[model samples]
Target: MLKRIATALWGKFESTAELKKFGFLAAIFGFIIGTYWTLRPMKDSIFNAIVGMDYLPWAKMLSLVVIFPLVIAYSKLIDKYPRHKVFYILISIYACASLLFCVAFLNATLGLVNTVQSPWRLIGWAWYVFVESFGSLIVALFWAFTTDTTKPDSAKRGFPIIVLFGQVGNILGPLLLNARRLGFANSAPVVAICAGLMVFSGLLFCKIT
Candidate 1:
Protein backbone atom coordinates (compact mmCIF):
# COMPACT_ATOMS: atom_id res chain seq x y z
CA MET A 1 0.00 0.00 0.00
CA LEU A 2 0.93 3.73 -0.04
CA LYS A 3 1.83 3.52 3.64
CA ARG A 4 4.45 0.89 2.89
CA ILE A 5 5.93 3.08 0.16
CA ALA A 6 6.04 6.06 2.47
CA THR A 7 7.73 4.10 5.23
CA ALA A 8 10.26 2.62 2.83
CA LEU A 9 11.21 6.05 1.50
CA TRP A 10 11.15 8.36 4.53
CA GLY A 11 11.38 5.82 7.37
CA LYS A 12 9.13 6.10 10.40
CA PHE A 13 9.21 9.37 12.33
CA GLU A 14 9.54 9.06 16.11
CA SER A 15 6.91 11.75 16.62
CA THR A 16 4.91 14.45 14.88
CA ALA A 17 7.51 17.04 15.82
CA GLU A 18 10.22 15.17 13.93
CA LEU A 19 7.96 14.81 10.90
CA LYS A 20 7.12 18.52 10.93
CA LYS A 21 10.77 19.49 11.16
CA PHE A 22 11.60 17.32 8.18
CA GLY A 23 8.75 18.81 6.17
CA PHE A 24 9.91 22.37 6.85
CA LEU A 25 13.48 21.53 5.96
CA ALA A 26 12.30 19.89 2.76
CA ALA A 27 10.21 22.94 1.84
CA ILE A 28 13.07 25.35 2.50
CA PHE A 29 15.48 23.30 0.41
CA GLY A 30 12.88 22.99 -2.34
CA PHE A 31 12.28 26.73 -2.63
CA ILE A 32 15.95 27.63 -2.59
CA ILE A 33 16.75 25.06 -5.25
CA GLY A 34 13.74 26.06 -7.31
CA THR A 35 14.77 29.68 -7.32
CA TYR A 36 18.30 28.72 -8.36
CA TRP A 37 17.10 26.58 -11.23
CA THR A 38 14.80 29.33 -12.39
CA LEU A 39 17.67 31.77 -12.45
CA ARG A 40 20.15 29.41 -14.13
CA PRO A 41 18.74 29.67 -17.64
CA MET A 42 18.22 33.38 -17.36
CA LYS A 43 21.89 33.82 -16.51
CA ASP A 44 22.95 32.59 -19.90
CA SER A 45 20.00 33.82 -21.92
CA ILE A 46 20.02 37.29 -20.50
CA PHE A 47 23.77 37.55 -20.81
CA ASN A 48 23.70 36.46 -24.41
CA ALA A 49 20.82 38.73 -25.18
CA ILE A 50 22.38 41.82 -23.67
CA VAL A 51 26.10 41.24 -24.08
CA GLY A 52 26.33 39.11 -27.19
CA MET A 53 27.30 35.43 -27.15
CA ASP A 54 30.80 36.35 -28.33
CA TYR A 55 31.64 37.57 -24.84
CA LEU A 56 30.19 34.55 -23.08
CA PRO A 57 33.54 32.84 -22.66
CA TRP A 58 35.07 35.96 -21.13
CA ALA A 59 32.13 36.30 -18.77
CA LYS A 60 32.65 32.71 -17.63
CA MET A 61 36.33 33.42 -17.11
CA LEU A 62 35.35 36.41 -15.01
CA SER A 63 33.25 34.14 -12.82
CA LEU A 64 36.20 31.82 -12.20
CA VAL A 65 38.37 34.76 -11.18
CA VAL A 66 35.60 36.19 -9.01
CA ILE A 67 34.54 33.01 -7.23
CA PHE A 68 37.75 32.50 -5.21
CA PRO A 69 37.50 35.83 -3.44
CA LEU A 70 33.78 35.27 -3.05
CA VAL A 71 34.30 31.97 -1.27
CA ILE A 72 36.85 33.53 1.06
CA ALA A 73 34.48 36.36 1.90
CA TYR A 74 31.71 33.84 2.48
CA SER A 75 33.92 31.95 4.92
CA LYS A 76 34.68 35.15 6.81
CA LEU A 77 30.98 35.90 6.93
CA ILE A 78 30.20 32.50 8.43
CA ASP A 79 32.85 33.07 11.07
CA LYS A 80 31.50 36.49 11.98
CA TYR A 81 27.82 35.60 12.19
CA PRO A 82 25.63 32.64 13.01
CA ARG A 83 24.71 30.50 10.00
CA HIS A 84 21.08 31.59 10.22
CA LYS A 85 22.11 35.22 10.25
CA VAL A 86 24.32 34.63 7.24
CA PHE A 87 21.41 32.98 5.48
CA TYR A 88 19.08 35.87 6.20
CA ILE A 89 21.64 38.46 5.21
CA LEU A 90 22.62 36.78 1.95
CA ILE A 91 19.02 36.11 0.99
CA SER A 92 18.00 39.69 1.70
CA ILE A 93 20.92 41.05 -0.28
CA TYR A 94 20.20 38.85 -3.29
CA ALA A 95 16.51 39.74 -3.15
CA CYS A 96 17.29 43.44 -3.24
CA ALA A 97 19.87 42.95 -5.97
CA SER A 98 17.39 41.01 -8.05
CA LEU A 99 14.89 43.83 -7.77
CA LEU A 100 17.56 46.31 -8.78
CA PHE A 101 18.40 44.21 -11.80
CA CYS A 102 14.72 43.99 -12.61
CA VAL A 103 14.51 47.77 -12.72
CA ALA A 104 17.66 48.00 -14.79
CA PHE A 105 16.28 45.48 -17.24
CA LEU A 106 13.24 47.74 -17.68
CA ASN A 107 15.44 50.61 -18.88
CA ALA A 108 15.84 50.66 -22.65
CA THR A 109 19.36 52.05 -22.51
CA LEU A 110 20.64 49.69 -19.84
CA GLY A 111 18.28 46.77 -20.32
CA LEU A 112 18.40 43.80 -22.67
CA VAL A 113 17.93 45.84 -25.85
CA ASN A 114 21.06 47.94 -25.64
CA THR A 115 23.88 47.20 -28.05
CA VAL A 116 26.90 45.46 -26.52
CA GLN A 117 29.24 48.21 -25.37
CA SER A 118 32.14 48.19 -22.89
CA PRO A 119 30.53 49.80 -19.81
CA TRP A 120 27.00 48.66 -20.52
CA ARG A 121 28.33 45.16 -21.12
CA LEU A 122 29.54 45.30 -17.54
CA ILE A 123 25.97 44.89 -16.33
CA GLY A 124 25.64 41.70 -18.32
CA TRP A 125 28.82 40.32 -16.81
CA ALA A 126 27.68 41.34 -13.36
CA TRP A 127 24.35 39.62 -13.88
CA TYR A 128 26.14 36.47 -14.96
CA VAL A 129 28.32 36.46 -11.87
CA PHE A 130 25.42 37.32 -9.63
CA VAL A 131 23.36 34.28 -10.58
CA GLU A 132 26.43 32.08 -10.81
CA SER A 133 27.58 32.94 -7.28
CA PHE A 134 24.07 32.61 -5.95
CA GLY A 135 23.82 29.05 -7.22
CA SER A 136 27.22 28.18 -5.77
CA LEU A 137 26.77 29.87 -2.40
CA ILE A 138 23.11 29.53 -1.49
CA VAL A 139 22.81 25.84 -2.30
CA ALA A 140 26.03 25.02 -0.47
CA LEU A 141 24.95 27.16 2.46
CA PHE A 142 21.64 25.30 2.70
CA TRP A 143 23.31 21.90 2.87
CA ALA A 144 26.00 23.13 5.26
CA PHE A 145 23.35 24.52 7.58
CA THR A 146 21.15 21.46 7.21
CA THR A 147 23.88 18.96 8.00
CA ASP A 148 25.08 21.12 10.85
CA THR A 149 21.68 21.17 12.48
CA THR A 150 20.33 17.73 11.58
CA LYS A 151 21.24 14.67 13.61
CA PRO A 152 22.80 11.77 11.73
CA ASP A 153 20.04 9.37 12.67
CA SER A 154 17.28 11.78 11.73
CA ALA A 155 19.14 12.76 8.59
CA LYS A 156 18.94 9.24 7.32
CA ARG A 157 15.17 9.57 7.29
CA GLY A 158 14.87 13.25 6.50
CA PHE A 159 17.49 13.77 3.81
CA PRO A 160 15.59 11.70 1.29
CA ILE A 161 12.50 13.81 1.80
CA ILE A 162 14.51 16.97 1.31
CA VAL A 163 16.20 15.67 -1.83
CA LEU A 164 12.90 14.53 -3.27
CA PHE A 165 11.31 17.93 -2.78
CA GLY A 166 14.41 19.64 -4.19
CA GLN A 167 14.15 17.56 -7.34
CA VAL A 168 10.54 18.57 -7.67
CA GLY A 169 11.60 22.20 -7.49
CA ASN A 170 14.28 21.61 -10.07
CA ILE A 171 11.67 20.31 -12.47
CA LEU A 172 8.92 22.83 -11.75
CA GLY A 173 11.06 25.97 -11.61
CA PRO A 174 11.85 26.03 -15.32
CA LEU A 175 8.49 24.58 -16.29
CA LEU A 176 6.51 27.31 -14.61
CA LEU A 177 8.77 30.01 -16.01
CA ASN A 178 8.36 28.89 -19.57
CA ALA A 179 8.26 31.95 -21.86
CA ARG A 180 5.14 30.85 -23.68
CA ARG A 181 3.09 31.18 -20.52
CA LEU A 182 4.79 34.32 -19.26
CA GLY A 183 4.06 35.84 -22.72
CA PHE A 184 7.24 37.83 -23.15
CA ALA A 185 10.97 37.38 -23.66
CA ASN A 186 11.93 40.05 -21.13
CA SER A 187 13.96 38.91 -18.11
CA ALA A 188 12.70 41.60 -15.72
CA PRO A 189 9.56 39.74 -14.71
CA VAL A 190 11.49 36.53 -14.19
CA VAL A 191 14.05 38.37 -12.08
CA ALA A 192 11.28 39.92 -9.98
CA ILE A 193 9.71 36.53 -9.40
CA CYS A 194 13.08 35.15 -8.34
CA ALA A 195 13.45 37.98 -5.80
CA GLY A 196 10.07 37.13 -4.34
CA LEU A 197 10.97 33.46 -4.12
CA MET A 198 14.24 34.29 -2.39
CA VAL A 199 12.37 36.33 0.20
CA PHE A 200 9.88 33.52 0.70
CA SER A 201 12.68 30.99 1.04
CA GLY A 202 14.25 33.13 3.76
CA LEU A 203 10.94 33.34 5.59
CA LEU A 204 10.53 29.57 5.35
CA PHE A 205 13.98 29.16 6.87
CA CYS A 206 12.90 31.49 9.66
CA LYS A 207 10.07 29.07 10.39
CA ILE A 208 12.55 26.20 10.35
CA THR A 209 14.64 27.90 13.02
Candidate 2:
Protein backbone atom coordinates (compact mmCIF):
# COMPACT_ATOMS: atom_id res chain seq x y z
CA MET A 1 0.00 0.00 0.00
CA LEU A 2 2.83 2.36 0.81
CA LYS A 3 4.54 1.43 -2.40
CA ARG A 4 1.37 2.21 -4.31
CA ILE A 5 1.11 5.58 -2.62
CA ALA A 6 4.75 6.31 -3.33
CA THR A 7 4.17 5.37 -6.95
CA ALA A 8 1.13 7.61 -7.34
CA LEU A 9 2.79 10.61 -5.70
CA TRP A 10 6.20 10.06 -7.20
CA GLY A 11 4.90 10.15 -10.72
CA LYS A 12 5.21 13.87 -10.31
CA PHE A 13 8.79 13.51 -9.16
CA GLU A 14 11.17 12.57 -11.92
CA SER A 15 14.03 11.70 -9.58
CA THR A 16 15.14 10.96 -6.04
CA ALA A 17 16.10 14.61 -5.65
CA GLU A 18 12.52 15.67 -6.22
CA LEU A 19 11.38 13.11 -3.68
CA LYS A 20 13.67 14.76 -1.18
CA LYS A 21 12.19 18.12 -1.96
CA PHE A 22 8.69 16.75 -1.65
CA GLY A 23 9.60 15.28 1.66
CA PHE A 24 10.88 18.65 2.81
CA LEU A 25 7.72 20.36 1.65
CA ALA A 26 5.60 17.85 3.48
CA ALA A 27 7.70 18.23 6.59
CA ILE A 28 7.44 22.01 6.53
CA PHE A 29 3.73 22.12 5.96
CA GLY A 30 3.10 19.39 8.46
CA PHE A 31 5.21 21.02 11.10
CA ILE A 32 3.60 24.39 10.77
CA ILE A 33 1.01 23.11 13.20
CA GLY A 34 3.70 23.35 15.84
CA THR A 35 3.75 27.13 15.66
CA TYR A 36 0.11 27.56 16.58
CA TRP A 37 -0.05 24.77 19.14
CA THR A 38 2.83 25.84 21.35
CA LEU A 39 1.16 29.11 22.27
CA ARG A 40 -2.02 27.45 23.42
CA PRO A 41 -1.46 27.70 27.17
CA MET A 42 -1.39 31.46 27.22
CA LYS A 43 -4.55 31.59 25.20
CA ASP A 44 -6.15 29.21 27.60
CA SER A 45 -5.29 31.55 30.43
CA ILE A 46 -6.82 34.52 28.71
CA PHE A 47 -9.88 32.49 27.89
CA ASN A 48 -10.28 31.09 31.36
CA ALA A 49 -9.65 34.41 33.05
CA ILE A 50 -12.24 35.97 30.85
CA VAL A 51 -14.54 33.04 31.42
CA GLY A 52 -14.06 32.62 35.20
CA MET A 53 -11.10 31.92 37.43
CA ASP A 54 -13.14 29.36 39.36
CA TYR A 55 -13.57 27.29 36.23
CA LEU A 56 -9.93 26.94 35.13
CA PRO A 57 -8.42 24.30 37.41
CA TRP A 58 -11.25 21.86 37.03
CA ALA A 59 -11.03 22.26 33.29
CA LYS A 60 -7.35 21.48 33.39
CA MET A 61 -7.99 18.38 35.46
CA LEU A 62 -10.67 17.24 33.08
CA SER A 63 -8.33 17.84 30.18
CA LEU A 64 -5.68 15.72 31.88
CA VAL A 65 -8.07 12.87 32.56
CA VAL A 66 -9.27 12.90 28.97
CA ILE A 67 -5.69 12.56 27.70
CA PHE A 68 -5.39 9.03 29.04
CA PRO A 69 -8.35 7.88 27.04
CA LEU A 70 -7.28 9.85 24.00
CA VAL A 71 -3.76 8.47 24.12
CA ILE A 72 -5.05 4.93 24.42
CA ALA A 73 -7.35 5.41 21.47
CA TYR A 74 -4.64 7.04 19.36
CA SER A 75 -2.16 4.28 20.10
CA LYS A 76 -4.70 1.85 18.68
CA LEU A 77 -5.47 4.17 15.81
CA ILE A 78 -1.80 4.41 14.86
CA ASP A 79 -1.59 0.66 14.66
CA LYS A 80 -4.26 0.61 11.96
CA TYR A 81 -3.49 3.58 9.69
CA PRO A 82 -0.63 4.15 7.27
CA ARG A 83 1.74 7.04 7.83
CA HIS A 84 0.32 9.25 5.09
CA LYS A 85 -3.25 8.41 5.88
CA VAL A 86 -2.65 9.13 9.53
CA PHE A 87 -1.18 12.47 8.67
CA TYR A 88 -4.13 13.30 6.48
CA ILE A 89 -6.61 12.23 9.10
CA LEU A 90 -4.79 14.03 11.89
CA ILE A 91 -4.51 17.29 10.03
CA SER A 92 -8.25 17.23 9.48
CA ILE A 93 -8.85 16.35 13.11
CA TYR A 94 -6.47 19.01 14.30
CA ALA A 95 -8.27 21.63 12.29
CA CYS A 96 -11.65 20.55 13.58
CA ALA A 97 -10.30 20.22 17.07
CA SER A 98 -8.93 23.72 16.95
CA LEU A 99 -12.25 25.06 15.77
CA LEU A 100 -14.18 23.24 18.46
CA PHE A 101 -11.74 24.48 21.03
CA CYS A 102 -12.26 28.01 19.85
CA VAL A 103 -15.98 27.50 20.15
CA ALA A 104 -15.78 26.08 23.66
CA PHE A 105 -13.46 28.81 24.84
CA LEU A 106 -15.30 31.61 23.15
CA ASN A 107 -18.56 30.36 24.50
CA ALA A 108 -17.01 30.45 27.92
CA THR A 109 -15.96 34.01 27.29
CA LEU A 110 -19.49 35.12 26.45
CA GLY A 111 -20.93 33.37 29.49
CA LEU A 112 -22.45 30.72 27.31
CA VAL A 113 -20.88 28.06 29.45
CA ASN A 114 -21.11 30.12 32.60
CA THR A 115 -22.89 28.37 35.44
CA VAL A 116 -23.37 31.22 37.94
CA GLN A 117 -22.74 29.07 41.02
CA SER A 118 -24.48 26.19 39.34
CA PRO A 119 -23.33 22.53 39.29
CA TRP A 120 -23.17 22.76 35.53
CA ARG A 121 -19.91 24.65 36.07
CA LEU A 122 -18.29 21.29 36.60
CA ILE A 123 -19.66 20.10 33.32
CA GLY A 124 -18.33 23.21 31.66
CA TRP A 125 -14.93 22.37 33.08
CA ALA A 126 -15.17 18.91 31.60
CA TRP A 127 -16.13 20.37 28.25
CA TYR A 128 -13.02 22.57 28.26
CA VAL A 129 -10.85 19.57 29.01
CA PHE A 130 -12.62 17.51 26.39
CA VAL A 131 -11.93 20.06 23.68
CA GLU A 132 -8.25 20.33 24.59
CA SER A 133 -7.77 16.57 24.37
CA PHE A 134 -8.47 16.52 20.65
CA GLY A 135 -5.76 19.06 19.94
CA SER A 136 -3.31 17.12 22.07
CA LEU A 137 -4.17 13.86 20.36
CA ILE A 138 -3.74 15.30 16.89
CA VAL A 139 -0.24 16.58 17.71
CA ALA A 140 0.84 13.23 19.09
CA LEU A 141 -0.46 11.46 15.98
CA PHE A 142 1.25 13.85 13.56
CA TRP A 143 4.66 13.41 15.18
CA ALA A 144 4.31 9.67 14.89
CA PHE A 145 3.41 10.04 11.23
CA THR A 146 6.42 12.27 10.60
CA THR A 147 8.87 9.77 12.08
CA ASP A 148 7.25 6.89 10.22
CA THR A 149 7.27 8.61 6.84
CA THR A 150 11.00 9.34 6.77
CA LYS A 151 13.17 6.59 5.26
CA PRO A 152 16.41 5.42 6.89
CA ASP A 153 18.52 7.65 4.68
CA SER A 154 16.09 10.52 5.00
CA ALA A 155 16.15 10.08 8.72
CA LYS A 156 19.86 10.65 8.68
CA ARG A 157 19.78 13.75 6.46
CA GLY A 158 16.26 15.06 6.87
CA PHE A 159 15.33 14.38 10.45
CA PRO A 160 17.35 17.36 11.63
CA ILE A 161 15.49 19.66 9.25
CA ILE A 162 12.18 18.06 10.05
CA VAL A 163 12.88 18.39 13.74
CA LEU A 164 13.64 22.01 13.21
CA PHE A 165 10.38 22.42 11.37
CA GLY A 166 8.67 20.91 14.38
CA GLN A 167 10.36 23.40 16.67
CA VAL A 168 9.21 26.14 14.36
CA GLY A 169 5.75 24.70 14.60
CA ASN A 170 6.04 24.84 18.37
CA ILE A 171 6.95 28.49 18.11
CA LEU A 172 4.09 29.10 15.74
CA GLY A 173 1.42 27.68 18.01
CA PRO A 174 2.14 30.23 20.70
CA LEU A 175 2.42 32.99 18.20
CA LEU A 176 -0.96 32.26 16.70
CA LEU A 177 -2.41 31.92 20.17
CA ASN A 178 -0.93 35.23 21.13
CA ALA A 179 -2.24 36.77 17.97
CA ARG A 180 -5.67 35.73 19.12
CA ARG A 181 -4.90 37.39 22.42
CA LEU A 182 -4.18 40.66 20.67
CA GLY A 183 -7.88 41.15 20.06
CA PHE A 184 -8.06 39.37 16.74
CA ALA A 185 -11.23 37.72 15.59
CA ASN A 186 -12.88 35.03 17.70
CA SER A 187 -10.80 31.91 18.33
CA ALA A 188 -13.66 29.69 17.26
CA PRO A 189 -13.87 31.30 13.84
CA VAL A 190 -10.11 31.23 13.30
CA VAL A 191 -9.78 27.61 14.30
CA ALA A 192 -12.79 26.70 12.20
CA ILE A 193 -10.99 28.16 9.20
CA CYS A 194 -7.98 26.02 10.03
CA ALA A 195 -10.28 22.99 10.01
CA GLY A 196 -11.09 23.77 6.42
CA LEU A 197 -7.39 23.90 5.65
CA MET A 198 -6.89 20.52 7.30
CA VAL A 199 -9.69 19.01 5.22
CA PHE A 200 -8.03 20.34 2.09
CA SER A 201 -4.73 18.88 3.16
CA GLY A 202 -6.41 15.56 3.92
CA LEU A 203 -7.70 15.44 0.37
CA LEU A 204 -4.22 15.95 -0.97
CA PHE A 205 -2.84 13.39 1.44
CA CYS A 206 -5.41 10.87 0.20
CA LYS A 207 -4.91 11.51 -3.48
CA ILE A 208 -1.13 11.71 -3.55
CA THR A 209 -0.34 9.23 -0.88
Which predicted model would earn the best lDDT? Answer: 1
lDDT of 1 by residue, 1-209 (tens): 53355567778866667777778888888888888999999898888888878888989999989988999999999999989899999999999999999989888888876755543567889999999999999988889899999899989988999999999999998889766579976768888998999999998888878
Candidate 2, residue 185: CA error in Å? 5.4
RMSD of each: 2.1, 7.0
TM-score of each: 0.93, 0.63
Candidate 2: stretches off by over 4 Å: 1-32, 35-39, 101-127, 130-135, 176-186, 200-208
The per-model lDDT (C-alpha) reads: 0.86, 0.56
What's the CA RMSD of model 1 in angstroms?
A: 2.1
Writing each residue's lDDT as its tens digit, candidate 2 over 152-204 gives: 66555545555566677667655654435657544445555555655665664
TM-score, predicted candidate 1 vs. hidden true structure: 0.93
